[model samples]
Target: MPFIIGTPIPDNKILVQSVSHIYGIGLSKSKMLCQRAGFGDDSRGLNVTPHKSKFLENLMDKSNLLLGADLRRFQNDKIRKLYTIMTYRGLRHKKGLPVRGQRTHTNAKKRAHFNTNVS
Candidate 1:
């Protein structure tokens, strides 16, 4: 059987890489998770035993790291707060412009195009 984390199993990937399929988990974190789960770095996803998978699931549950829907919800909430506060970043988000002060005149063509398309 395939191991399911935040989503469907990535049976074709190496176990270290496969764990990164979970939202919010990056390559470094995935490697850390493999170590903590007592799985070797070279382990393949299909070779993950039920016990190891369960151990991983439990570790994720106990960790502060958010995955999948929870991470999305947290980000959405943060953006909502920014929007509600009417900060500069919020205004940029509302206007569909770059928020980090990237030069909009030359850069952010995609965002500019998106704004124009909406009208």
Candidate 2:
């Protein structure tokens, strides 16, 4: 395993896949990063070289991209704001119910009764 942007990825992970271990970068963004870093399909990096790591750090800094703990904190802050605002979704979230308007008539059976004996 190796660390990129403070996230550990499997040693054998593809270059594009390796970059996606960071919280904010998805597959598409990872491909873009690999291309920008000149890491091609053949670059089976055993580990990120110091030069490559430095380049990536600079790129992320220039792009103002948030990763890892920073992204998690941002997401948590947004959810916490919703809770403080008492939004319908926040109430639903607090109740452990579907917050996306999902039908609950046949699904949220917290105390469903079942017959136990054959007549």
Candidate 3:
């Protein structure tokens, strides 16, 4: 398994999928990264040689994309900011409920179950 940005790439997965295991990267972005790194569709994670991996890493570094833990931290900070401002979405997050206008009339029972904070 190759480690990229402190995340492990599953050797059994196809290269693009394995790359997508990294946070903030999805299927399309992973495919683009692989294409940029000169990897083909059939490439597996195990085929990521040190040089190729380095090239991939360099590509990620050079790109202005926010990724991995930094991306996660940035999102969390945004949520935290919303919470400080007491926004509706922040309240929903604090209540452990769906924040995107999801109706809690019925399907949100599971979320309600975890919402121990009453009022």
Best by lDDT: 3
Number of the top TM-score candidate: 3
Candidate 1 lDDT for residue 107: 83
For model 1 the local lDDT of residue 103 reads: 96
Candidate 3: where is the Cα deviation over 4 Å?
Answer: 116-119
Name model 2 segments beyond 4 Å from true.
Answer: 108-119
Model 2, span 61-113: residue lDDT tens? 77787787898999888877887899997766656667788887998655223
Which residue pairs in candidate 2 collide? none
Evaluation by lDDT, superior candidate among 2 and 3: 3
**Rank by lDDT, descending?**
3, 1, 2
Collision count for each candidate, in order: 0, 0, 0
lDDT of 1 at 42: 74
Q: Is candidate 1 or candidate 3 better by lDDT?
A: 3
CA RMSD of all predictions: 2.1, 7.0, 1.6
